[model samples]
Target: MLKLGWFSTGRDQAARDLLKVVWQRIKEGFISAQISYVFLSREPGESKESDLFLKLCQELGLKIYTLSAKNFEPGLRQNNREAWRAAYHQKVYEMIKHEPVDLIVLAGYMWVVSAELCQKLPMINLHPALPGGPQGTWQEVIWQLLQEEANETGVMMHLVTPELDQGPAVTFCRFPIKGGEFDPLWQNFKEKMRQIGLEKIKEQEGEKEPLFALIRKEGVKRELPLIVYTIKAFAEKEISLINHKLFDNKGNLLLEPYDLTERIEKHLKTGEW
Candidate 1:
Protein backbone atom coordinates (compact mmCIF):
# COMPACT_ATOMS: atom_id res chain seq x y z
CA MET A 1 0.00 0.00 0.00
CA LEU A 2 1.10 3.53 -0.68
CA LYS A 3 2.32 5.17 2.50
CA LEU A 4 1.55 8.81 3.18
CA GLY A 5 2.04 11.39 5.91
CA TRP A 6 -0.29 14.31 6.51
CA PHE A 7 0.69 17.76 7.75
CA SER A 8 -2.01 20.15 8.80
CA THR A 9 -3.06 22.79 11.31
CA GLY A 10 -6.69 21.64 11.56
CA ARG A 11 -7.89 25.22 11.69
CA ASP A 12 -10.24 25.48 8.72
CA GLN A 13 -13.02 23.67 6.93
CA ALA A 14 -11.01 23.45 3.72
CA ALA A 15 -8.53 21.05 5.27
CA ARG A 16 -11.34 19.00 6.78
CA ASP A 17 -13.13 18.95 3.46
CA LEU A 18 -9.98 17.82 1.70
CA LEU A 19 -9.43 15.03 4.20
CA LYS A 20 -13.03 13.91 3.72
CA VAL A 21 -12.47 13.68 -0.01
CA VAL A 22 -9.36 11.59 0.49
CA TRP A 23 -11.21 9.23 2.78
CA GLN A 24 -14.08 8.91 0.33
CA ARG A 25 -11.74 8.20 -2.55
CA ILE A 26 -9.92 5.55 -0.58
CA LYS A 27 -13.22 3.86 0.19
CA GLU A 28 -14.22 3.90 -3.49
CA GLY A 29 -10.92 2.38 -4.72
CA PHE A 30 -9.73 5.55 -6.38
CA ILE A 31 -6.68 5.54 -4.12
CA SER A 32 -5.07 2.45 -2.67
CA ALA A 33 -3.08 4.26 -0.03
CA GLN A 34 -2.78 4.28 3.75
CA ILE A 35 -2.12 7.24 5.96
CA SER A 36 0.89 6.25 8.01
CA TYR A 37 1.12 9.28 10.28
CA VAL A 38 -0.03 12.84 10.88
CA PHE A 39 2.16 15.78 11.96
CA LEU A 40 0.41 18.80 13.34
CA SER A 41 1.82 22.26 14.06
CA ARG A 42 -0.62 23.05 16.85
CA GLU A 43 -0.13 21.87 20.39
CA PRO A 44 -2.07 18.70 21.20
CA GLY A 45 -4.42 20.40 23.64
CA GLU A 46 -5.24 23.40 21.49
CA SER A 47 -7.03 21.79 18.54
CA LYS A 48 -10.43 20.15 18.73
CA GLU A 49 -10.26 19.53 15.00
CA SER A 50 -6.99 17.74 15.47
CA ASP A 51 -8.63 15.53 18.03
CA LEU A 52 -11.41 14.66 15.60
CA PHE A 53 -8.92 13.93 12.84
CA LEU A 54 -6.96 11.67 15.15
CA LYS A 55 -10.11 9.75 15.98
CA LEU A 56 -10.85 9.28 12.30
CA CYS A 57 -7.36 7.98 11.72
CA GLN A 58 -7.82 5.56 14.57
CA GLU A 59 -10.99 4.27 12.94
CA LEU A 60 -9.03 3.80 9.73
CA GLY A 61 -6.29 1.99 11.70
CA LEU A 62 -3.58 4.45 10.80
CA LYS A 63 -0.62 5.29 13.05
CA ILE A 64 -0.61 8.91 14.24
CA TYR A 65 2.28 11.12 15.42
CA THR A 66 2.48 14.77 16.35
CA LEU A 67 5.11 17.52 16.71
CA SER A 68 4.27 20.75 18.45
CA ALA A 69 5.59 24.14 17.42
CA LYS A 70 5.59 25.17 21.07
CA ASN A 71 8.43 22.77 21.73
CA PHE A 72 10.61 24.93 19.51
CA GLU A 73 9.88 28.09 21.45
CA PRO A 74 11.63 31.38 22.22
CA GLY A 75 15.13 30.04 21.95
CA LEU A 76 14.74 29.09 18.31
CA ARG A 77 12.16 31.72 17.36
CA GLN A 78 12.87 35.00 19.18
CA ASN A 79 16.30 34.59 20.72
CA ASN A 80 17.99 33.40 17.52
CA ARG A 81 16.12 32.96 14.24
CA GLU A 82 18.54 30.80 12.24
CA ALA A 83 19.53 28.64 15.16
CA TRP A 84 15.90 28.14 16.06
CA ARG A 85 15.04 27.31 12.48
CA ALA A 86 17.94 24.89 12.20
CA ALA A 87 16.90 23.12 15.38
CA TYR A 88 13.31 22.96 14.20
CA HIS A 89 14.42 21.57 10.83
CA GLN A 90 16.41 18.85 12.58
CA LYS A 91 13.31 17.83 14.50
CA VAL A 92 11.23 17.50 11.31
CA TYR A 93 14.06 15.73 9.52
CA GLU A 94 14.29 13.22 12.32
CA MET A 95 10.56 12.54 12.18
CA ILE A 96 10.49 11.87 8.44
CA LYS A 97 13.78 10.04 8.58
CA HIS A 98 12.41 7.54 11.05
CA GLU A 99 8.90 7.23 9.65
CA PRO A 100 7.81 4.98 6.81
CA VAL A 101 6.54 7.65 4.46
CA ASP A 102 6.39 7.86 0.69
CA LEU A 103 4.68 11.20 0.21
CA ILE A 104 4.02 14.24 2.37
CA VAL A 105 0.81 16.20 1.93
CA LEU A 106 0.12 19.55 3.53
CA ALA A 107 -3.48 20.31 4.38
CA GLY A 108 -3.86 23.85 5.70
CA TYR A 109 -0.49 23.80 7.46
CA MET A 110 -0.06 27.41 8.63
CA TRP A 111 3.71 27.37 9.02
CA VAL A 112 5.88 27.20 5.95
CA VAL A 113 7.74 23.91 5.58
CA SER A 114 11.40 24.55 5.89
CA ALA A 115 13.64 24.13 2.81
CA GLU A 116 15.44 21.28 4.55
CA LEU A 117 12.16 19.42 4.91
CA CYS A 118 11.18 20.03 1.29
CA GLN A 119 14.44 18.51 0.05
CA LYS A 120 13.90 15.36 2.09
CA LEU A 121 10.79 14.14 0.31
CA PRO A 122 8.10 14.72 -2.28
CA MET A 123 5.53 17.18 -0.98
CA ILE A 124 2.30 18.69 -2.28
CA ASN A 125 -0.04 21.46 -1.10
CA LEU A 126 -3.53 22.64 -1.92
CA HIS A 127 -3.81 26.37 -2.26
CA PRO A 128 -7.00 28.42 -2.61
CA ALA A 129 -6.12 30.20 -5.81
CA LEU A 130 -4.86 28.87 -9.11
CA PRO A 131 -1.12 28.94 -9.55
CA GLY A 132 0.37 32.26 -10.68
CA GLY A 133 -2.53 34.17 -9.14
CA PRO A 134 -2.23 36.60 -6.25
CA GLN A 135 0.32 35.59 -3.57
CA GLY A 136 -0.93 35.64 -0.01
CA THR A 137 -2.69 33.53 2.60
CA TRP A 138 -5.85 31.75 1.45
CA GLN A 139 -8.15 34.37 2.96
CA GLU A 140 -6.11 37.13 1.35
CA VAL A 141 -6.40 35.40 -1.99
CA ILE A 142 -10.20 35.34 -1.72
CA TRP A 143 -10.43 38.92 -0.51
CA GLN A 144 -8.26 40.15 -3.35
CA LEU A 145 -10.28 38.25 -5.93
CA LEU A 146 -13.51 39.74 -4.59
CA GLN A 147 -12.05 43.24 -4.39
CA GLU A 148 -10.89 42.98 -8.00
CA GLU A 149 -14.34 41.89 -9.12
CA ALA A 150 -12.92 38.66 -10.42
CA ASN A 151 -15.54 36.50 -12.10
CA GLU A 152 -13.64 33.28 -11.61
CA THR A 153 -11.21 31.60 -9.21
CA GLY A 154 -9.91 28.11 -8.53
CA VAL A 155 -8.03 25.66 -6.29
CA MET A 156 -4.84 23.82 -7.22
CA MET A 157 -2.88 20.88 -5.88
CA HIS A 158 0.71 21.70 -6.64
CA LEU A 159 4.16 20.38 -5.77
CA VAL A 160 5.46 22.15 -2.69
CA THR A 161 8.60 24.23 -3.09
CA PRO A 162 10.53 26.72 -0.96
CA GLU A 163 8.87 29.78 -2.46
CA LEU A 164 5.47 29.82 -0.78
CA ASP A 165 2.74 28.88 -3.30
CA GLN A 166 4.91 29.25 -6.40
CA GLY A 167 5.16 25.52 -6.98
CA PRO A 168 4.44 23.85 -10.29
CA ALA A 169 0.82 22.92 -10.98
CA VAL A 170 -0.60 19.43 -10.78
CA THR A 171 -4.39 19.69 -11.11
CA PHE A 172 -6.62 22.77 -11.01
CA CYS A 173 -10.40 23.07 -11.06
CA ARG A 174 -12.17 26.39 -11.65
CA PHE A 175 -15.64 27.68 -10.87
CA PRO A 176 -17.57 30.78 -11.74
CA ILE A 177 -18.82 33.55 -9.50
CA LYS A 178 -21.67 35.41 -11.17
CA GLY A 179 -21.67 38.84 -9.62
CA GLY A 180 -25.36 39.53 -10.28
CA GLU A 181 -26.52 36.11 -9.10
CA PHE A 182 -24.50 36.26 -5.89
CA ASP A 183 -26.07 39.57 -4.87
CA PRO A 184 -28.94 37.86 -3.11
CA LEU A 185 -26.62 35.67 -1.03
CA TRP A 186 -24.54 38.71 -0.18
CA GLN A 187 -27.61 40.70 0.84
CA ASN A 188 -28.91 37.85 2.94
CA PHE A 189 -25.62 37.47 4.78
CA LYS A 190 -25.43 41.23 5.33
CA GLU A 191 -28.92 41.36 6.80
CA LYS A 192 -28.11 38.42 9.03
CA MET A 193 -25.04 40.28 10.22
CA ARG A 194 -27.12 43.38 10.81
CA GLN A 195 -29.60 41.39 12.89
CA ILE A 196 -26.71 39.95 14.85
CA GLY A 197 -25.60 43.54 15.49
CA LEU A 198 -23.10 45.54 13.42
CA GLU A 199 -20.68 45.59 16.35
CA LYS A 200 -20.15 41.83 15.99
CA ILE A 201 -19.48 42.34 12.29
CA LYS A 202 -17.19 45.29 12.97
CA GLU A 203 -15.08 43.11 15.20
CA GLN A 204 -15.05 40.36 12.57
CA GLU A 205 -14.93 42.19 9.26
CA GLY A 206 -12.37 39.88 7.63
CA GLU A 207 -14.21 36.81 8.84
CA LYS A 208 -17.71 37.95 7.78
CA GLU A 209 -18.52 37.78 4.11
CA PRO A 210 -21.37 36.81 1.84
CA LEU A 211 -18.81 36.10 -0.87
CA PHE A 212 -16.95 33.62 1.35
CA ALA A 213 -20.17 31.82 2.18
CA LEU A 214 -20.86 31.49 -1.53
CA ILE A 215 -17.30 30.42 -2.26
CA ARG A 216 -17.53 27.80 0.46
CA LYS A 217 -20.75 26.54 -1.09
CA GLU A 218 -18.96 26.18 -4.40
CA GLY A 219 -16.01 24.51 -2.68
CA VAL A 220 -18.23 21.82 -1.20
CA LYS A 221 -19.56 21.18 -4.68
CA ARG A 222 -16.18 20.98 -6.44
CA GLU A 223 -13.72 19.76 -3.82
CA LEU A 224 -14.49 16.06 -4.07
CA PRO A 225 -14.08 15.79 -7.82
CA LEU A 226 -10.85 17.76 -7.80
CA ILE A 227 -9.26 15.69 -5.05
CA VAL A 228 -10.33 12.46 -6.70
CA TYR A 229 -8.89 13.47 -10.04
CA THR A 230 -5.61 14.63 -8.54
CA ILE A 231 -5.19 11.57 -6.35
CA LYS A 232 -6.10 9.21 -9.18
CA ALA A 233 -3.46 10.80 -11.33
CA PHE A 234 -0.89 10.43 -8.60
CA ALA A 235 -1.83 6.83 -7.80
CA GLU A 236 -1.53 5.81 -11.43
CA LYS A 237 1.96 7.32 -11.63
CA GLU A 238 0.62 9.74 -14.24
CA ILE A 239 2.32 12.76 -12.72
CA SER A 240 6.01 13.55 -12.19
CA LEU A 241 8.14 16.28 -10.67
CA ILE A 242 11.20 17.23 -12.68
CA ASN A 243 13.31 20.19 -11.61
CA HIS A 244 10.38 21.19 -9.42
CA LYS A 245 7.99 21.24 -12.41
CA LEU A 246 4.95 19.02 -12.84
CA PHE A 247 4.48 17.00 -16.00
CA ASP A 248 1.75 14.71 -17.25
CA ASN A 249 2.16 11.09 -18.31
CA LYS A 250 3.60 12.19 -21.66
CA GLY A 251 6.20 14.48 -20.12
CA ASN A 252 4.34 17.66 -21.11
CA LEU A 253 3.48 20.30 -18.55
CA LEU A 254 0.04 19.82 -17.00
CA LEU A 255 -1.39 23.24 -17.76
CA GLU A 256 -4.92 23.27 -16.45
CA PRO A 257 -4.99 27.03 -15.97
CA TYR A 258 -8.39 28.59 -15.23
CA ASP A 259 -10.21 31.38 -17.00
CA LEU A 260 -12.62 33.38 -14.84
CA THR A 261 -15.16 35.25 -17.02
CA GLU A 262 -15.04 32.61 -19.69
CA ARG A 263 -16.03 29.91 -17.23
CA ILE A 264 -18.81 32.13 -15.94
CA GLU A 265 -20.05 32.75 -19.46
CA LYS A 266 -20.04 29.04 -20.25
CA HIS A 267 -21.89 28.20 -17.06
CA LEU A 268 -24.40 30.91 -17.80
CA LYS A 269 -24.81 29.47 -21.25
CA THR A 270 -24.97 25.71 -20.49
CA GLY A 271 -24.97 25.39 -16.69
CA GLU A 272 -22.36 22.60 -17.01
CA TRP A 273 -18.62 21.85 -17.25
Candidate 2:
Protein backbone atom coordinates (compact mmCIF):
# COMPACT_ATOMS: atom_id res chain seq x y z
CA MET A 1 0.00 0.00 0.00
CA LEU A 2 1.17 3.51 -0.76
CA LYS A 3 1.61 5.74 2.27
CA LEU A 4 0.00 9.10 1.53
CA GLY A 5 0.72 12.39 3.25
CA TRP A 6 -1.93 15.08 3.10
CA PHE A 7 -1.52 18.87 3.24
CA SER A 8 -4.30 21.37 3.45
CA THR A 9 -5.15 24.76 4.85
CA GLY A 10 -8.55 23.47 5.96
CA ARG A 11 -9.99 26.82 5.03
CA ASP A 12 -13.50 25.81 3.98
CA GLN A 13 -16.17 23.17 3.58
CA ALA A 14 -14.66 21.70 0.42
CA ALA A 15 -11.51 20.96 2.44
CA ARG A 16 -13.40 18.91 5.04
CA ASP A 17 -15.64 17.20 2.48
CA LEU A 18 -12.66 16.02 0.45
CA LEU A 19 -10.98 14.49 3.48
CA LYS A 20 -14.19 12.73 4.43
CA VAL A 21 -14.66 11.30 0.96
CA VAL A 22 -11.06 10.14 0.61
CA TRP A 23 -11.10 8.56 4.07
CA GLN A 24 -14.37 6.82 3.26
CA ARG A 25 -12.94 5.52 0.02
CA ILE A 26 -9.93 4.14 1.84
CA LYS A 27 -12.15 2.42 4.42
CA GLU A 28 -14.23 0.95 1.59
CA GLY A 29 -11.08 -0.41 -0.03
CA PHE A 30 -11.57 1.71 -3.12
CA ILE A 31 -8.07 3.15 -2.90
CA SER A 32 -5.25 0.76 -2.13
CA ALA A 33 -3.51 3.09 0.29
CA GLN A 34 -3.67 4.62 3.74
CA ILE A 35 -3.07 8.20 4.73
CA SER A 36 -0.02 8.31 6.98
CA TYR A 37 -0.18 11.91 8.13
CA VAL A 38 -2.21 15.06 7.60
CA PHE A 39 -0.41 18.38 7.88
CA LEU A 40 -2.36 21.58 8.32
CA SER A 41 -1.02 25.09 8.00
CA ARG A 42 -3.44 26.45 10.56
CA GLU A 43 -3.76 25.88 14.29
CA PRO A 44 -6.77 25.51 16.55
CA GLY A 45 -9.12 28.51 16.53
CA GLU A 46 -7.49 29.86 13.38
CA SER A 47 -10.99 30.11 11.98
CA LYS A 48 -14.33 28.40 12.57
CA GLU A 49 -14.02 26.62 9.22
CA SER A 50 -10.65 25.14 10.03
CA ASP A 51 -11.71 24.32 13.59
CA LEU A 52 -14.54 22.16 12.24
CA PHE A 53 -12.07 20.53 9.90
CA LEU A 54 -9.81 19.76 12.89
CA LYS A 55 -12.73 18.28 14.84
CA LEU A 56 -13.53 15.97 11.93
CA CYS A 57 -9.90 14.88 11.67
CA GLN A 58 -9.84 14.02 15.39
CA GLU A 59 -13.06 12.07 15.01
CA LEU A 60 -11.54 10.13 12.13
CA GLY A 61 -8.42 9.27 14.22
CA LEU A 62 -6.09 10.61 11.57
CA LYS A 63 -2.70 11.77 12.82
CA ILE A 64 -2.49 15.56 12.36
CA TYR A 65 0.34 18.05 12.81
CA THR A 66 -0.31 21.78 12.68
CA LEU A 67 2.16 24.64 12.42
CA SER A 68 0.89 28.17 12.46
CA ALA A 69 2.06 29.91 9.33
CA LYS A 70 0.03 32.84 10.61
CA ASN A 71 2.17 33.26 13.72
CA PHE A 72 5.52 31.94 12.57
CA GLU A 73 8.40 34.44 12.46
CA PRO A 74 6.29 37.51 11.89
CA GLY A 75 9.33 39.71 11.27
CA LEU A 76 10.68 37.72 8.33
CA ARG A 77 7.25 37.13 6.82
CA GLN A 78 6.59 40.84 6.86
CA ASN A 79 9.95 41.93 5.48
CA ASN A 80 10.71 39.21 2.93
CA ARG A 81 8.06 36.89 1.53
CA GLU A 82 10.42 34.82 -0.65
CA ALA A 83 12.86 34.13 2.17
CA TRP A 84 9.93 33.58 4.51
CA ARG A 85 8.48 30.95 2.17
CA ALA A 86 11.79 29.13 2.04
CA ALA A 87 12.28 29.32 5.80
CA TYR A 88 8.69 28.30 6.46
CA HIS A 89 8.89 25.25 4.19
CA GLN A 90 12.20 24.26 5.77
CA LYS A 91 10.53 24.15 9.19
CA VAL A 92 7.62 22.18 7.73
CA TYR A 93 10.12 19.70 6.26
CA GLU A 94 11.84 19.35 9.61
CA MET A 95 8.58 18.52 11.30
CA ILE A 96 7.59 15.78 8.85
CA LYS A 97 11.00 14.45 7.84
CA HIS A 98 10.84 11.51 10.21
CA GLU A 99 7.59 10.13 8.85
CA PRO A 100 8.24 8.93 5.34
CA VAL A 101 5.39 8.93 2.83
CA ASP A 102 5.36 7.63 -0.73
CA LEU A 103 3.40 10.61 -1.99
CA ILE A 104 2.32 13.95 -0.59
CA VAL A 105 -1.04 15.27 -1.74
CA LEU A 106 -1.71 19.00 -1.66
CA ALA A 107 -5.39 19.64 -1.07
CA GLY A 108 -6.42 23.24 -0.46
CA TYR A 109 -2.85 24.14 0.40
CA MET A 110 -2.76 27.89 -0.33
CA TRP A 111 0.90 28.60 -0.09
CA VAL A 112 3.38 28.09 -2.91
CA VAL A 113 6.00 25.46 -2.18
CA SER A 114 9.67 26.27 -2.27
CA ALA A 115 12.12 24.74 -4.77
CA GLU A 116 14.11 23.07 -2.02
CA LEU A 117 10.99 21.48 -0.55
CA CYS A 118 9.81 20.44 -4.02
CA GLN A 119 13.04 18.51 -4.54
CA LYS A 120 12.72 16.74 -1.19
CA LEU A 121 9.13 15.59 -1.49
CA PRO A 122 7.15 13.53 -3.97
CA MET A 123 4.17 15.88 -4.14
CA ILE A 124 1.12 16.26 -6.37
CA ASN A 125 -1.59 18.90 -6.50
CA LEU A 126 -4.96 18.81 -8.22
CA HIS A 127 -5.16 21.68 -10.67
CA PRO A 128 -8.66 22.48 -11.92
CA ALA A 129 -7.62 22.74 -15.54
CA LEU A 130 -6.54 20.20 -18.11
CA PRO A 131 -2.83 19.41 -18.48
CA GLY A 132 -2.42 22.36 -20.86
CA GLY A 133 -5.74 24.15 -20.51
CA PRO A 134 -5.14 27.08 -18.16
CA GLN A 135 -3.07 28.01 -15.11
CA GLY A 136 -4.51 29.84 -12.13
CA THR A 137 -6.87 29.37 -9.23
CA TRP A 138 -9.96 27.36 -10.17
CA GLN A 139 -12.11 30.47 -10.32
CA GLU A 140 -9.60 32.19 -12.55
CA VAL A 141 -9.33 29.11 -14.73
CA ILE A 142 -13.09 28.91 -15.14
CA TRP A 143 -13.30 32.59 -15.99
CA GLN A 144 -10.60 32.19 -18.60
CA LEU A 145 -12.37 29.22 -20.13
CA LEU A 146 -15.57 31.22 -20.50
CA GLN A 147 -13.71 34.18 -21.93
CA GLU A 148 -11.95 31.96 -24.44
CA GLU A 149 -15.24 30.38 -25.52
CA ALA A 150 -13.41 27.14 -24.93
CA ASN A 151 -15.30 23.95 -25.64
CA GLU A 152 -13.35 21.66 -23.35
CA THR A 153 -11.44 21.65 -20.08
CA GLY A 154 -10.41 19.21 -17.35
CA VAL A 155 -8.80 18.60 -14.00
CA MET A 156 -5.40 17.01 -13.45
CA MET A 157 -3.10 15.67 -10.77
CA HIS A 158 0.17 17.49 -11.34
CA LEU A 159 3.62 17.25 -9.85
CA VAL A 160 4.17 20.27 -7.64
CA THR A 161 7.11 22.39 -8.67
CA PRO A 162 8.47 25.69 -7.40
CA GLU A 163 6.68 27.36 -10.30
CA LEU A 164 3.04 27.48 -9.37
CA ASP A 165 0.70 25.29 -11.45
CA GLN A 166 3.31 24.81 -14.19
CA GLY A 167 4.12 21.27 -13.09
CA PRO A 168 3.66 18.35 -15.46
CA ALA A 169 0.52 16.35 -14.87
CA VAL A 170 0.46 12.76 -13.60
CA THR A 171 -3.09 12.07 -14.75
CA PHE A 172 -5.97 14.10 -16.16
CA CYS A 173 -9.51 13.78 -17.50
CA ARG A 174 -11.14 16.16 -19.95
CA PHE A 175 -14.78 16.93 -20.67
CA PRO A 176 -16.42 19.04 -23.33
CA ILE A 177 -18.12 22.28 -22.33
CA LYS A 178 -20.22 22.51 -25.52
CA GLY A 179 -22.54 19.52 -25.69
CA GLY A 180 -25.69 18.28 -23.98
CA GLU A 181 -26.10 20.10 -20.66
CA PHE A 182 -23.70 22.85 -21.65
CA ASP A 183 -25.53 23.86 -24.85
CA PRO A 184 -28.51 25.55 -23.22
CA LEU A 185 -26.30 27.08 -20.54
CA TRP A 186 -24.01 28.59 -23.16
CA GLN A 187 -26.96 29.96 -25.09
CA ASN A 188 -28.28 31.59 -21.93
CA PHE A 189 -24.83 33.00 -21.27
CA LYS A 190 -24.59 34.48 -24.77
CA GLU A 191 -27.98 36.16 -24.31
CA LYS A 192 -26.87 37.54 -20.95
CA MET A 193 -23.60 38.68 -22.49
CA ARG A 194 -25.57 40.61 -25.06
CA GLN A 195 -27.95 42.08 -22.46
CA ILE A 196 -25.07 43.13 -20.18
CA GLY A 197 -21.45 42.93 -21.18
CA LEU A 198 -19.23 40.09 -19.98
CA GLU A 199 -17.61 42.48 -17.51
CA LYS A 200 -20.99 43.42 -16.06
CA ILE A 201 -21.99 39.78 -15.81
CA LYS A 202 -18.76 39.05 -14.02
CA GLU A 203 -19.12 42.02 -11.71
CA GLN A 204 -22.66 41.07 -10.71
CA GLU A 205 -23.24 37.37 -11.42
CA GLY A 206 -19.72 35.98 -10.91
CA GLU A 207 -19.77 32.23 -10.25
CA LYS A 208 -23.55 32.22 -10.15
CA GLU A 209 -23.70 32.67 -13.91
CA PRO A 210 -25.50 29.64 -15.34
CA LEU A 211 -22.72 28.51 -17.62
CA PHE A 212 -20.08 29.18 -15.00
CA ALA A 213 -22.01 27.35 -12.31
CA LEU A 214 -22.45 24.29 -14.51
CA ILE A 215 -18.78 24.31 -15.41
CA ARG A 216 -17.80 24.38 -11.77
CA LYS A 217 -20.41 21.74 -10.94
CA GLU A 218 -19.14 19.42 -13.64
CA GLY A 219 -15.54 19.96 -12.55
CA VAL A 220 -16.26 19.55 -8.82
CA LYS A 221 -18.01 16.23 -9.39
CA ARG A 222 -14.82 14.90 -10.93
CA GLU A 223 -12.31 16.20 -8.37
CA LEU A 224 -12.81 13.61 -5.63
CA PRO A 225 -12.72 10.81 -8.18
CA LEU A 226 -9.68 12.28 -9.90
CA ILE A 227 -7.77 12.44 -6.64
CA VAL A 228 -8.77 9.03 -5.26
CA TYR A 229 -8.15 7.19 -8.52
CA THR A 230 -4.83 8.93 -8.89
CA ILE A 231 -3.98 7.65 -5.45
CA LYS A 232 -5.22 4.22 -6.51
CA ALA A 233 -2.92 4.35 -9.53
CA PHE A 234 0.00 5.16 -7.26
CA ALA A 235 -0.83 2.51 -4.66
CA GLU A 236 -1.12 -0.25 -7.26
CA LYS A 237 2.20 0.77 -8.80
CA GLU A 238 0.51 1.57 -12.08
CA ILE A 239 2.47 4.80 -11.83
CA SER A 240 5.76 5.47 -10.09
CA LEU A 241 7.61 8.60 -9.01
CA ILE A 242 11.34 8.47 -9.54
CA ASN A 243 13.45 11.62 -9.10
CA HIS A 244 10.21 13.63 -9.39
CA LYS A 245 9.44 12.13 -12.80
CA LEU A 246 6.46 9.84 -13.42
CA PHE A 247 6.92 6.47 -15.07
CA ASP A 248 4.58 3.63 -15.95
CA ASN A 249 4.93 0.23 -14.24
CA LYS A 250 6.84 -1.07 -17.25
CA GLY A 251 9.56 1.58 -16.60
CA ASN A 252 8.62 3.82 -19.51
CA LEU A 253 8.48 7.55 -18.80
CA LEU A 254 5.01 9.07 -18.97
CA LEU A 255 5.37 11.88 -21.50
CA GLU A 256 1.94 13.13 -20.57
CA PRO A 257 -0.48 12.73 -17.70
CA TYR A 258 -2.39 9.46 -18.14
CA ASP A 259 -6.02 10.00 -19.15
CA LEU A 260 -8.75 8.87 -16.76
CA THR A 261 -11.88 10.20 -18.55
CA GLU A 262 -13.25 6.73 -19.38
CA ARG A 263 -12.77 5.57 -15.80
CA ILE A 264 -14.20 8.73 -14.29
CA GLU A 265 -17.16 8.81 -16.65
CA LYS A 266 -17.82 5.13 -15.91
CA HIS A 267 -17.99 5.89 -12.22
CA LEU A 268 -20.16 8.90 -12.85
CA LYS A 269 -22.51 6.79 -14.93
CA THR A 270 -22.63 3.40 -13.17
CA GLY A 271 -21.08 4.23 -9.77
CA GLU A 272 -18.21 1.86 -10.56
CA TRP A 273 -14.63 3.07 -10.62
Candidate with top TM-score is 2
Which candidate gets the maximum lDDT versus the true structure?
A: 2
Candidate 2 local lDDT, residue 256:
71
List runs of model 1 lying over 4 Å from the truth.
Answer: 12-14, 79-86, 183-204, 242-245, 252-273
Query: For every model in order, what is the number of clashing pairs?
Result: 1, 0
lDDT of 2 at 90: 96
lDDT of 1 by residue, 1-273 (tens): 566788877676666666766766677776877667777666566677776766666776666666776667666588876567667767877866788666678877877777767766778877777667767776677666755666677777778877778877677767766667776765665575658754465367655566766775675555545655666566676775555566777878767632233443354467443
> How well does candidate 1 score on lDDT at residue 257?
35
Cα lDDT listed for each candidate: 0.67, 0.91
lDDT of candidate 2 at residue 254, scale 0 to 100: 84
